[model samples]
Each structure stands twice: as C-alpha cells, then as structure tokens.
Target: MRKYPIGIQDFEKIRKENFLYIDKTQSIYNLIASGNYYFLSRPRRFGKSLLLSTIKEIFSGNRELFKDLWIYNQWNWEQKHPVIHLRLSKLDYQKLGLYEALSIEIGILAKEQGVELESKHLKGRFEELIRKASANGKVVILIDEYDKPITDYLDDLGKVEENRSIFKSFYSVLKDSDPYIRLLLITGVSRFPKVSIFSDLNNLNDITIHRKYATIAGITQQELERDFADEIAEIQQHQPDFLGKLKSWYNGYAWHEEAERVYNPFSLLKYMDGRDFRNYWFHTGTPTWLVNIMKQNREYDLENVHIGENALSSFNVEHIAVIPVLFQTGYLTIKGYNSNNRLYKLGYPNTEVRESLTDALLSAYRNVFPGNDSMSVTDDLSESLKKNDMPQMIKALDVLLSTIPYDHWKAESESIFHIIVHLSFKRLGFDVRSEVHSATGRCDVLVFTDRYIFALELKLNSSANVALDQIFEKGYLRPYQMDARKKIAIGINFSSEKRNVQDYLVKELE
Candidate 1:
C-alpha cells in the first residue's frame, strides 16, 4: 500500500510522508555537475514542478531527504546554498498583472530568507534579493513554468506583448547577477525565442532536447519496472499484456531523438492506482487554443510530421507554428531523426494523446461537442464497420459531415471531406491511413478493423462508378491481398452543393 504522489509536487512532503519517489537524483546530480545555468522545456504534468522541488530541497541542505536516493553519498553534503524558487503558475498574475504579481512573489522569497530589499522596481528588487540572499553563499534560482504569464494570454496579443516585455526586463537581471547565482534552472511548457526572454541572459543551457538530460523529468521504462514492480505484478495477474498495454497508453515521450522513451508519470501513476487504462493526463486540461490553431490551419494530418531543428525549437507571440506548439505542449513527440538532414519526425506520443487529440480536433472541425453528437456518430460508424454495414456507415458519415456549419467550409471541398472522414474513423479507434501509396496507384484512404480491411477511393463531384472503376483499374487492394482479413473496396463521391456524401459503392475483393 505505497502512497503514489498523484498531484503532489513537493519533494519534502513526498520524502517525509513515505510516498513512492522515483529516484531522479542521479540525473539531477549530473545536471548540476555539467552546468550552472540550464533551461528545460517539458509539457505540463510531466514532472517539471517535481524536478524543481527536488532540486530546491537538495540546495537547501536537506541531506536526510536523500538517505536512500542515488545521490545520497555521491557528493559532499556540507555545501549548502540559499534557494530562491519561484513557480509562475502559482503567481496571481491574472489579477495583479505580471509586474505586480512577480514583485510580490520575489518579496515573499526575500522575507522567507530574512533578507531586506531596498529596490522598488521589479528588476532591481530581484537583483537585490539574489545578491542579499547569497551573502552567505551563492543562491540557487529555480523558476518553474517560466512562460505561463505569456502563454496564458496567447489569444490577446496586447497582453502577451506586455507580459513578454515585463519578463524580458525582469529576467535580464540574472545576467548581471551571475556572480551571486550558484545555479539556475528554468522550466516551461513553451520555449519563447531567446530575444524575447533570454537575449540578455544568453548563458542558460537549453537541455530540452539535449541527449544527456532528456530523461531528467519523465519516468523511464527502466525506472518504472524497477520502482513499481509490485504494482505491475498485481496488474499483470489479470491482464497478461498489462505492461505492453501500459507502454502503448502512457509511454513514448522522447525529447532527444536517440534517448530512451519515457512515460507520462501522472498518467502512469493514475493507471497504477486505479488499474484502469484511461486518458488521465489529458483530462486535466483541454488545449482550446491549440485546437483552434489547428482548425484555423486545416492541419489534421498529425502523424509522421517532418521538421528541421530550427522549426521545432522555439516560437514567439508574433509567429507561432503548429508543429512546434504541438511538440512543446506534449501533443506530439520525437519519433525519428535524420542526422544528415537534421530533420525530426514528430507524432502523437501514445494512444492517450493520439485518441484524445483526435477527438478534440474532430469535435472542433465538425462543430459538435464531444460525447454529445460526435461520439454517437463515431460509435455508430465503428459499429457499422465492425458489422460490415455499408449503408449504415455511409449514413453516419453523412450525419457527421452535415453537422459542420456552412461557414466553416473554408478549405477545398475534397480536402475537407477527406479530413472529416479520416478523423471520424480515427476517432472510433480504427487504423486509418490517408493518401496511402501502392505500386500502381495511391488509395485515398485505407482503413483496417479487427476482421476487415477497407481500401477506399474518394472522388469529388464525380460518379461513384468512376471512383470504383479507378480502384479496380489501379489494383489498390493488391497490397493487402495477404492481409488474411476480409478485403473490401469502397468508392465514395461527395457533392459540393449537398455538402454531404452523395453516393458510394462497395465491393468485396477476391
């Protein structure tokens, strides 16, 4: 009956209260030994706050807390530094404004350290606090969620710029106060451009994608098996594929291309506690702004996205890219990388993110609320596919398409139709491949169920007979001839005027 630290980010509490603590102290020690100034960008609930908390305790000379940890006897415990920890997410910035809220936070830190600040300005106060706190020794500064104040106001350009400017000026103090700082680590969800926040403080080493520190925050597979063997064994008794299923549901996050994949600790802990596979991490918050951005760009094809290092690294308020935002926010993760071209292949980290994000995107595209209208349509579609009910499937597709508001049809009719169909099938947990290539030709969509394989060709403002003829003429089902499942060929046509499925033909491939 070990206590899982679900939602608990305090290291002292987890250690003192006998909670299950995954020892990440080895990586922490390596981080401190390697550099003094570091910046790490990880998605929310991926244990960024907990990492900072652990570091805070270590610097505060809490040697007893690390009695059984890996770093207990690795180094000298005599050296202690004053820790100035600030979590931007906890600051009342929305109500007090960024400047005032930050001022109050820093003032509180100074009071805790019994140091007096004579400066009235935010930047001056921060510098004064650091210098005074380091009177005995250099201060270890840890700022968690460093970009929350700006990211929370993304929809409002005026407020975003205002907060960005405030942070720029405030953080610049760190550059001149380097002598008083023993170590600095800033963690955030998004990496704003250096010019925005780190232009003056250019010494901060960004370990977000650094290979050595990639597993510094998340729970690795090795750590999972070693730390939670008892819980895993208990779950394995009933479900033979418990570990595999857990990996597919909660693992596959990789910051560096060559690093070992890590699981979302929050989701993993929840699954272990309840012995149920659920989207535990996604339910905590919905990325409404991210969904809106994807919808605006008509970018639904999220798998196998290829981008260079520069495009995947950082973004700012003036220019925001979908892939970087997706990568930074945990919707996507590094799957592959080409060193020659310096291109990274990004995709959904695991089943939880893939399914949950697809549901969100599909709901937004179809203008239907999730679990209300979209869920019924997708469930019906899934049931129809499983039963080989062609007419019912077509009806479900028509209903799904018809729900979209007329004004939302900005993209080309065929493209929009393909996106909706692909998303609908994906939302139902089907294996769907869009624009699949074959030897002779390319199929519009290929769907695979447990007992059936569907090769679909789509035509816009054309006859279903022509579409069916092309599917046969091109031999689209040739690739799946040995798939062992019942192979079916489908040709569908849509009318721009009707804005729904006009007609379709289905044929069983021998």
Candidate 2:
C-alpha cells in the first residue's frame, strides 16, 4: 500500500517515501558496464528522470536501497562512484535562453556537491563543476531531458540553434573530463544528431532507436500487471470491463525488437489514479510541440497516411546538424523495418498516441462534426450490406451525390473542404478514397462500400454536370464497375464560400 510516485522524478524522494517502483535498474546496470557515455531517447514521462535518479543511486554505492531489487543480487555492490547528477529540465523554458538555463542547471547540481560556479562564462562555470566532480573522483554524469530548451524553441529557429550551441559547449566539457567520468548517461525526449548537442562527444552511444534497449524506459504490460495489479483492480471496480478499457486507451506503443509493444508509462499511471482513461500520455507534453514542428514544416498530411521511415525525419531545422528534430522529439517512432530494405515504417508510437493524434488532427486538419451523420447517409448502404442491394446502392448515387457541400467551394476553404468530406464518410465504414483517377480528371472523393463504388468530385462553384462528366470521361468508376459490387458515379460540387454540402449527382455504371 505504499504511495506511487506518479509524477515524482526524484529518486531520493521517491525511495525514502517507500513508493511503488517497478525495477528498471538492470538496464542501468548493463548500460553502465556497457559504455562510458550513453544517450537514450524516449518519450516524455517514460521515466527518464527516474532512471537518471536510479543511476545516481547505483553510482553512490547506495546498495542498501536496492534490497531484493534485480541489481542488488545481480551486480557487484562493492563498487560505488561519486555521482554528479545535473537535471536540465527544471529550468524555465520561456524565461531563459540556453546559456542562462544551463547556468541554472549547473548551479543546482554543483550546489549539491558543495561546489558553486562563481564564473559568468558557461565554459568557465562548467569547468569549475567538472573540476569539483573530478576532484572528488570521476563523476557519473546523468542529464534529464537534455534537449528541452532547443525543443521548446523549435518554432523559433533562432533559439533552437542558440540552445544547440549552448549545449554543444556544455556537453563538450564531458569530453574534456573523459578521464574522470565513470559512466555518462543522458536522457532526452529525442536524440539529436552527433554533430549538434553531443558535438564534443561524437562517440556518445545513441540507443534511442536501438532495438536492444527500447523497453528500458517504459512499462511493459507484464510489469504493469505485476506491480500495479491492485491499482488496476481498484480502478476497474467502477467499470464493467477495465482490462479492455486499459488496452484500448494505452496499449499501442511499440519501440523494439522488430515487434514489441508498450503502454505509455506517464498516461498509464494517471489513468490508474483518476480511474479515467484520459490521454495521460499527452498530458501537456510531446504532442502539441510536435504538432508545432509539423505545422512549421507543413509535413503533417491531412489527406493521406504515410508508413515509410524518414518521411518526416528528413526536414532539419536550421542550424541543427543532427538527426531530424522530429524523430528525436517522440512524435514519430520506428514502427517496423525490413532488414533487406533498411527501410523503417515510422508512425505515432501507440494506440493512445494515434487516437490522441487523430483527435487533434480531426480538429486541426478537418471539420468533422460530432455523431452519426454517416450512418444516416449510409444506412441504405448498411442495409445494402445486409440485403446485398447493389441496385439500390447504385441508384442511391443521386441521393449520395446530393450531399456535397457546394457552398463550401465558393467559400474557398481549399484543403479543408476535401478533408472534411473524406473523413466524414470514412466514419461510415466506407473506404473513403480521395483524389482518385477518373476519365476527365481526378475525383475529389470516391467512397466504396461493399455494395457500390462512389466517384465524387468537389469544386468551388462547380456544377454537378462537370463533376459527373469528370467521373464518366476519366472513367473514375470504370475500374470498380466490373466488381461484384454495383458501380456508381457520383459528382459532388462544393462551394468554398460556404461550409456545407450544396449539390451531389449519382448515376449507375454498367
């Protein structure tokens, strides 16, 4: 019945309080022995700070705190090194630029070690801190959210570069103190390219997308059941099906081994606390900032879905000589990869992220209204599915055609009009295709149900005859006409001037 350190990132505080902790120490134990400087990139609140604290604990030779834990019995506890933990995320992102923020961070970590930075210059101050740690013995460097400042200023390219410059010099100090460093482990939301933040330390091992350790930071489903079973049971008491709810809300993050899945640790805990499956993962971090990056780059697609790796990863923010800022930021993650192709499928990491992102996109990308409007339009299609009403479905093209927002085009919303209609009908369980090829040209939309295929064209102040003729001349419905399902040609004209469906046309294809 110990307290769970829900958002508490400090190891000492959480440990002394006897809070519930799922052991992730083995990875640290392995990591320390494995490399001198290790860079790990995980999503926000995936327990990076806690991991940093855990490293501090291990390095301090605080073996007594780890009784019955995996590392205590597994590791040789005879060794303990002096640890210098610098938490960088604590600085105010808006109030200070990179230099000032680094100064504050250095001062705090140095204060704990009884060595203050009396100098104003960053290099001079960091030199003093490193000297203190080395004077005591090699420092075990642990930095949390190392990229917060740059990421905060992602919109302001000026600041991203400034922050990168500041960190480059700051982290380079580690290279100078390479001899005194016992184990250097830095955690951030995403990995910067070698030339940027870690410029001074090119050899820094980046284990962000490394398949071997993706599970190190987040909670495994097994761990959740084992450590928080009671909490889950407690939360589920109000729900008829708690397990299903948990799975749907939180069970879709996969980060390793070609095929691995994980729940978002931050969201999962809060959901346990409130017993409501809120978007605990998006709790004011990662998503919107990522959305900003997309908006700035104009890379987020409203119409199509992409599954290729490096699709969004190629856009580099100015003055940043590193990995694509997007991948490091946790908005995009490796989905699946083929060894032969060296190609990876990148996507939003989990079910919660996908749905949360979709909800955000629906609001940001499209103008979808709430509720079952699609069912009203497709009830006949639904019936057609049941009764196999190809004839009725093909004939219903006229009625379906009538649903276009003709006024929306004259209004000139551009992409908004097309995106809304496609998403609207997509909700009805039809494979909502957009920009489909036709005899006259490309149709704006083509919704295909089990019973019939629909070809639609949307335009501002365009007539149904033009939309329908495009369908007929371009042979938009020709490809699907031979299918067992009835073929239907429907032309929809949208008025950009207004945002509602204005006119639609439907015709049967042989």
Candidate 3:
C-alpha cells in the first residue's frame, strides 16, 4: 500500500514523504567507509541518481533523515562535509559546447559557497570551487551521469575528441585537489577509462565488477520477495504464475558473473504499478543507435559472442568496439567468465531484452516491422510442422524472408540472412540455438518449441538438397532422436540476386 518512488530522486523527499524505500543504506555505508574515490557504472534508470542523492544526504550530516536507516548511528554525523553534487545529464552538450556547460555549472556552484571566481577556464574555476567549499572540511564530490556529455557525441568523433580534451582538463583538478576532497563518487553508464580523459584520475577504484557492490542499485531477488511479499500474494490470488513470469521477463541483470542477479528496479516498480508483466524496461531507453552501429559493422552479428576480459572494459572515445558498447550499455550482460582464459561469454540478460533487442534489430535492417505478422510467421511455421505440412512451412518462410529489402541482401553476407532467421524465430518465443553442436558436427540453427524440434540448415548460392544431405550425413538430428518432441530436418536455399528463398526441402524423422 506504499507509494513507489517512480521519479523521486531526492533522498530527503522520499524519506519524509513516506514513499517505498528498499533499504540500500547498508551498501552506502560500506561504499563510504571503504574508499575515498570510487566509480560505479550501471544502466540508465537503474537508480544511480538516487544513490548519489542518498550519499549527498549522508555526507552533508543530515542526521534526521537517517533515523531508521542502517547507517543512522554507524555514521559520524558530527563532521559535516559540504557536498558539491553535479549531474552532467542536465546540460545539452550538443547545443552548447562542453566547456560552456561546465563553466555555467561551476559558476553557479562557486556562487553558492559564497566564493567568486574570475577565471574564464573550466579547470581553474573547478579548482577554486573545491578549495572554497572545503574551507571548513573536506568536500564530498558526487557526479551523476559523468559520461553524458561525451556519450551524447558518440556518432561524431571530432566532437567527441574535443569534449574529451575539455573533460581531461576539468577532471584533472580532482587529482591535484585530492588533499581537500573527502570522498569522490562518479556514476555513469559506461567505464571507458582507457580514454586519455580519465588518465589523470588514476586513483579511482572501479567497483563495477566488485561483488560487494553488485546489488547496490538494482533490486535483488531477496529484496523483491521480502519487500513486495504482499504485492506478490495479492497478484497470485488471481494469477498463480505471476512471480515466475515476472522473473523470466525482468530479473536477470548481473553485474558480476557469479553475483546474484537483480531485477531492473524501474521496470519492476512500473510492473507493480500497472499489474502487468510487459516489456516495461526496454522502452525506457531504447538503444536505436546501437542497433544501427551493429548493422553497419558487419563483424558484429552478436550471436555466440565472446570477448577478452580486458576488452570487456577497455574502450576509448576514438575507437569504441561493438562488444564493449553493447556490454556497457546493458543490451548484453556477462553470461559466463573464464578466469583461466581471461575471456567473457556475453548474451542478452533475460527474455525482455532478448525479444525487444531482436525486434529493434529486425526493424532496423529490414522493411518488415516486428509485430503480430512476425508472430504469425512463427505460429504458421509451428502449426505447419505439427501437421506435417511441408509446403505450408516453406510458404511461411518465403513470406518471412521476402520482407528483407533487396539492397541489404546485395550488400550484406549470408550471416545477415542467418541472423534474420535466428532473430525471427527467437522473437516468436521459441528456444532458438544458433550454431548448435551435436555429437558429430554443428548445425546452423536449432529451434525448439513445446512439442516440435527443428534442425534447419541454410545455404547461400548452393543447392537445397546439398544442405539437406549435409544435415542427414552429419546426423544433426541425432541429439533429439529419443526426445518426445517430433523432429523435422529442413534445408532452405537463398538467392543473392532474387533476395529471397529459391528452394526448400524438408524431411520429418520417424
């Protein structure tokens, strides 16, 4: 019966107004006690701003706000630190240059501390503010969305370089003014520290992958089951499987490979508000540009993707790779980490991202938008396979393949076609496994429904019978031979000139 803090980012407002608060004060206490300078990277709307606001209150010696919180008596409230909080998300870096945005904010902050700075440069102005604010005690610096200005210019390399220079000069003051700084916490969406902009601030402890802080921003399963037990009980009175459905939809965001996964706080709260388990998280900040970049870079088909541990967090503004961008931006997450090999296996975190990202990619690369028609395509395929209607299944595939534009077929490789087929079936709620391995060899695509299993082999500029022959010879259907689901072997040939399916052959296993 408590009101959820949907847009309230202020800690004082939430506590005083009696809004629902999932106690994160323990994590805040740990973070503040353990380090002097720290960095945390989380996805947008994942409660980064709120965390910074809470830290601001704690450092400012607001004792009344912490009456019932975990850090109430544990923290030292006698020493009050002047908190200088800056949110880079407020500035429009595209319209106003990066320097001007910093200058304006720094000017206002300096005036608040009863200090005037005549310096026209950003670095000088920032240093003056730090010195003046810490006249009584060390300054607590909290920067939310620290990479917003630079991220706003991701498409323009020239502008990005200019902004990086500005940031490097401005942030270098933190290193020099470390004597007057009590605690510095920087929160952003990405941690591309290899860029020269962050080179001078070398003492920052990046807790992004640290297991102790993984549950700082998002709602852990323990918090969900405990904090919203009443809500769950009420919903299950009508729908018994709501909890399972909710977990499958929005509950698999993992910061560390072995850390406990947490539910997206924004989507979970909105779902509780609407009482519906929909794709609420994906719509918050859709990465349309990410999809466009992936489509442009042909090397990034993103199926069964793996990257080195260093490559996971190592990107610069000048040369940002597709894997790091996707991983940092929350489209992909750490599925598995091999410490011996120093490699990470990345994939979509949950069903919402898997389906929504596929829909976005399908819409970006082709004329066909993902909707009921695409759903019907898979539905038709499922029905055709169940009734043993080979022609109907082939016809359904033809219609689906024809939706792709002709130019895309000419310019892209066979991998694009494979991705389209893979994503199409995946978006339809089928358990699709690309590049699946069997006893002898690997199959191109394997689709599993409730009662049917499809082993599809795709060929470009080759005979359909040849593809079907390879499937039989390699025993691609061997793994599912004894399963209860009916097995179907399908071979489809695509023509580069026609940009559609040229031939199709199918054989059902007895």
Candidate 4:
C-alpha cells in the first residue's frame, strides 16, 4: 500500500517516506537539456512546488532519491551544484514587507550554504549570494510562486505597485549573475508584464504554453492510469464507470491545445483518498478577488472564449483582463487553437471548475456567502429535473431566484433571467448551453440530461403562453428531434415587480 503524497511538496521526503511518486524526472531531464532559464505558470496546487523541489534535489546530487526514476542513470550524479531554493508563497511578506521578507529569505539561504554576504540591499545581497554559492559550480535557482507578493495584494493598488517595484529591483540581479547561475526555474500562477524580471531577463524561456513541456507540471492521462492502476482497479469494483466518471469530473486541463489533457493532481489525490467526488481543488482556495471580478463582468460568457496568442500570454497588473486571469489561474484552459489566425479557444477545463465557479459567481451575485440555501435549491432543482417533475422544478427555480438581491434584478431584462437560470442549471452539473443557435432560430437555453433534453424560452414581463408559442414557432426543438432522450419544451416568464418566476409552462414532445 503506497501512501499518497497529499499536500506534500518535498521531493526528498516523498521518496524517502515511501509515498507514491509519479516519476516526472524524464520531463525534468528534457527541460534541463533544453534550457537553462525557464518560467512556468500553473494554478495553485498543480505541483509547481514539487517540480521545483525535484529539480532542487537533482542539482544537489540526491542520487538515492531517484533510484528507480528515469533520471537515476541518465543524470551525471558526480556533477553537483549548490541550489538556492526560494518559495515566495512561504515567505512572510504579509507580516514583513516584501523587501524585508525577501532579504531574510536570501540571508537564510546564504546561511544554509555557509556563505556570508556583505551587501546592504536586496539586489546586491542576491547577487553576492549567487556568486558565492557558485564557488564550486554554477548555482541552480528555484523560485516557486515568484509572483505571490504581487498577487496577494491585488486588491491594493499601492501595495501591488510597491511589491512590483521591489520584485523588479530584487530580480534585476539575475541577468547580471547569469554566468554564475546554472539553471533558473521560476514558477508562478500569473506572468505580469512590466515586472522587469521578464523584460530584463531576455533569455528566460516561458514554457507555460510551450507544446514540448505542456505536461511537465500536471499529471497526464497516461501518468494517472499508469501510476494509480491499483487504485483505479479497486474503485472500479464498486463503481464500474469510475474511470469515465473520473475523466469527466477532473481530467481536462490542457496547456497546449494539441497536447494531452491532464488531471488536477491535488483533486485526484483527494478523491483517491476519500473515494468521494467533490470540489477538492476549488475548495482549497478560490480567490475572493477572482469571484468579484467575475461578478463585475457578468456579460462575458465563460465558454468558447477566443484570445490571441500574445494577449493570452501575459497581462499588466494595472490593466488586468478577466479571461487571461481565468486562464492563468486554471478556471479556463485552451480547448482549440488556429495556427492561421494565432487564436486560442478557451473554456472551463472540466466539470469541477464549471460547477464550482458557477456556484461562486452565483453567491457573489446574491451577495451571500457560499454554502447558502441557493445551493440546496439548485440541488432540489437537479432532483426535480432528474425525475421530470416540472412543477417541483419550477418551485425550486422560483426559490433560487427569490434569493437573489433586488439590486441584481433591478436591470429587469430577459438576459438577466436567462443568465440566472443558466447558472442555476449549470451549477446543478447539467449539460447547459445558453443562447443556443440553430438553423431556424436561437433558443434561450438548452439543457441536456442523461434521460431528457429540454428546450427553454425565457421572457420578462410577458406571459408564459407567449414564450411557449415562440419556442414552438421558432422550431427550437428541431435540432434535438433525433436525440434519444425524452424531449421537453419549457417556457418561463419573470415579473420585475415580483423578482421571481411568475409563470412557467412545460410540455412533452414526441
């Protein structure tokens, strides 16, 4: 029974403690062979720290840690380089300022390596530490979550700019110390432009979307099946569709549009340990700022977002774009790419993000905390849809709508009702598409379930009869005529005065 290294980011500890380590040394070897300076951007808990830790151990000549791994024989163990490992997420920037926190961290590293620095400021000390640590050989620098200081204070413009300035000064040492550095790999959740580290360090290769190293950070499908074969077999005994369900729930994260999708390793491990399917990764931490941003930009659809390659790569902190932030933070991922136009199509990575993010956005819109009764109401709506209980479904939807604050409903447009209803069904984990277009006409929403398909038309300050007539008149159900599931047509009307569903009609179609 091999132990899962849940929340454990230390490579040496995982190997020595007999944890089930997914061998990523092959990718690491390729990375080292390909470049000396690299930057990786991945969402939180996707094993960026572990990757850096593994590289640190490798450079430190930890041969025993890679005994059975791919790099054990491939690497030249005789060649050892001093490593300067810094995890910005672990730094005390909140208590101490960025400059002081970084100074202490570098000082500790220098102390560990038995080196003394005479420099007074961060830039000089960092340069001094690198040159001294490379006395025997060039130093390998691993900086994990390098942008944490800036990201942590996004709500405060002054603090963000201050941290940016501090980072710009501190990282300026890297370009001058290149001769003393063997390899530098910086991992973070986002790459902000004008950080100077990026502009000054012109040699740094950003492999965030590079096809060759797309699978370097996340656990690919092959790795998952190859690694957790025993766990899968055991789970399949009771849940026969376990593999398929798992893929649907968690295995759709892709960095390159053509690369194989990977699973959120943290969430996968949690599911393996508990044998329960929940929002493991999203629950660990969803940035309140991200949720607030989504609430402010409610008009932007979360699916099929198209962005240019350059625009998708980096954004400035002063002018942040929600789509790029969503993509960088793992809420969205590359789904398709057009080489001719250099455009990337992005969407929700998988069911986990779609459902969890929708719930969070709904909570923000309602001005309530998460885990409110709206979630249970959505659950009730799901149950009603599963049983084809039209009356119960309408009642549940009404309750959900009633919970929304009056300010949200002040707009009193059909689109708002459509968005709320779409979000409600989407949060229920159904296959939902809003403003679906067909040859004849467009439908307000279309919901697909295992046993039923629904064509819905929404109207505000109008009668449900008119909405139902439009649904049939527009031939919204024509496209799903051949679908095997039971087909139903639903029309709903919302009253601005009541701020809830006023009337709804549901009809079965052959």
- lDDT of candidate 1 at residue 454, scale 0 to 100: 90
Residue 439 of model 1: what lDDT?
A: 83
lDDT of 3 by residue, 91-178 (tens): 7666778899889998887776777887888889999899988997999999999888878778888887788888888898999899
* lDDT for position 473 in model 3: 94
Prediction 3 TM-score vs. true: 0.92
Question: lDDT at 374 for candidate 1?
Answer: 62
Between candidates 3 and 4, the one scoring higher on lDDT is 4
Tell me which residue pairs clash in candidate 3: none
Q: Give the best candidate by lDDT.
A: 1
Better of 2 and 3 by TM-score: 3
Cα lDDT tens digits, model 1, 53-73, are 999888888899999899999
State in Å the error of residue 74, model 2. 1.6
- Evaluation by lDDT, superior candidate among 2 and 3: 3
For model 4, the run of ten residues with the poorest summed lDDT? 368-377
Taking the tens digit of each residue's C-alpha lDDT, what string does model 4 give over 204-246? 8888998888888778888988999999889888899989989
Off by over 4 Å in 1: 369-373, 386-388, 402-412, 437-442, 449-452, 473-487, 496-499
* Displacement of the residue 414 alpha carbon in candidate 2, Å: 5.2
Residue 478 accuracy (lDDT) in model 2: 67
TM-score of each: 0.94, 0.78, 0.92, 0.94
